[model samples]
Target: MREANHFNERRTAQAAAFLLHRSGGQLPLIKLMKLLYLAERKSLELYGVPITGDKLVSMPNGPVLSKTYDHMNGAAMSEPGGWDSWISDRAEHMVALLDPSMIRTPEQDLLQLSDSDLEMLQSVWIDFGHWDRWQLVKYTHDKLPEWEDPQGSSQAITYEKLFQVFGFGKEQTDALIERISAQAYLAKV
Candidate 1:
């Protein structure tokens, strides 16, 4: 098994900025979460690495990037991290882009996303961006087999489980994880 990786807050902010940019600089919290999850799912399917190395979990709604959700809802007691610098959550629970140029911040390069990753974000937005939060939740629950109904409890959904759904054998999955882990380290270096 591959060692667990820490969450990359920079990448998480980039993903949020991407969604906000596509949604005219503002999005409801639930919709933002859906878009982030979709992009992460696509990244794993295509590149065998997540855009953000955050924990993925099943919530009552759907699959959530656990830490990113916390960051958005202000449940983490954080301030001016990568995400906070670029995004702001209003009283209505909607997140908006505070500074469009924040996407060009120093953390930009640390996001470590390739052109293909950008493609996934744009394509996912194009295809599913119109859906409301509940619709998106229903869609994810129906389409993503790894999503179990948490039924008010949260459940961690590991990469191994995702790889299984993608029909990857143990050896192939392990190798992919190793490669992704190495690439992530190299990017940080």
Candidate 2:
């Protein structure tokens, strides 16, 4: 995971499920991606860590959760409890929860999500959920300092770069990234 920067599919699934649940169990693919990217950005800003811990990348549309994007596009996941378990296949560029039944109760646990993760999801929703998909894209392109125009290709958006934008110095950013890598390694073990 440290070398590949692979994410916890189960946690990411729950995060996606939580967002889809908030959007009445469905959202356009780009819209859902934008919402998840924004939530991850906000979490990194406020909590000093990303909610899904997925690798971030700047794409043509905007910033994206790379592996999550692959999963959204029906790529085979290497792990169980992946996006397919919680969300439906892309239908007309829209995604819905596979089990709206599980999302019926507001009190029910969204598997692998933490309280802080939920807080960030709600914060992102309150701040930008009502905006249309294009609006969210525009905001990410224009407002977020971490995103670089990939110019027809994608570029990794490092936690170091994001930390710099968040007012962290080089030493601190390097230390934090190293810590995160160590943690990722330990989790894999």
Candidate 3:
């Protein structure tokens, strides 16, 4: 019984971290509850917990599971209560059994980018600022240049030039480049 309680607490903490991470460090009660439900489900599968649907009831002020799940289909709009507050409250309640470090942070590292790479990034950003995922992908396929190895290329572009052109701090630009590289989205100049 003690072990079960401890597991539940850790699961709850992990759920909180997943929710906070996905929501960019904040989430409404509804969204958080839904994430918690999914996290708990994953935990059960992995840990062989005897927890059932009924055992996953929400706190009095928290969202009910059904309503919480339903909210996932709704449009992305701000909930009445602040997202930060809800996450903080739940996090505090579960802190005793939860590890705060379990939460994942957003990617913040920079990847190497050539001058051509920076140009492609800027162009894509400009062209698809308002585009959805499919539209962006389609546009990239139709219009973007193919990436090539910079090793043998004679392109004179440097990080300093990219910084000057993009008007982003060196660190910020590098992080963006790194993210693009990770996604295999960097374009060669």
Evaluated at residue 44, the lDDT of candidate 1 is 88
Give the alpha carbon lDDT tens digit for every residue of 1-189 in model 3. Answer: 001111122223333444354434554444344334433333333332211121333232321233223323232232433122123433422312123343333222111222332333334334433344344334323432221223442222232332334355767655544543443322222
C-alpha root-mean-square deviation, each candidate? 3.0, 2.2, 21.6
lDDT of 2 by residue, 20-104 (tens): 8888889999999999988888877776766777889999999999999998998856466667779889989998999888776
RMSD of 2: 2.2
lDDT of 1 at 46: 80
TM-score of 1: 0.87
Candidate 2 matches the true fold with a TM-score of 0.92
Q: Give the total clashing residue pairs for model 3.
A: 3
Q: What is the lDDT of residue 46 in candidate 2?
A: 77
The runs of at least 3 residues in candidate 2 whose Cα sits more than 4 Å from the true structure, single-residue gaps closed, are 1-6, 104-107
For this target, which candidate reaches the highest lDDT against the unseen true structure? 2
Tens digits of per-residue lDDT for model 1, 1-189: 333355777678877888788787898898999999999888888878888878889998999999898888887654445777677765586889877655554335425455776778888999999989889999889999989999898888888888899999999898887887787788678
Q: Write down the lDDT of every candidate, Cα atoms only.
A: 0.80, 0.82, 0.33
Better of 1 and 3 by lDDT: 1
Ranking by lDDT: 2, 1, 3
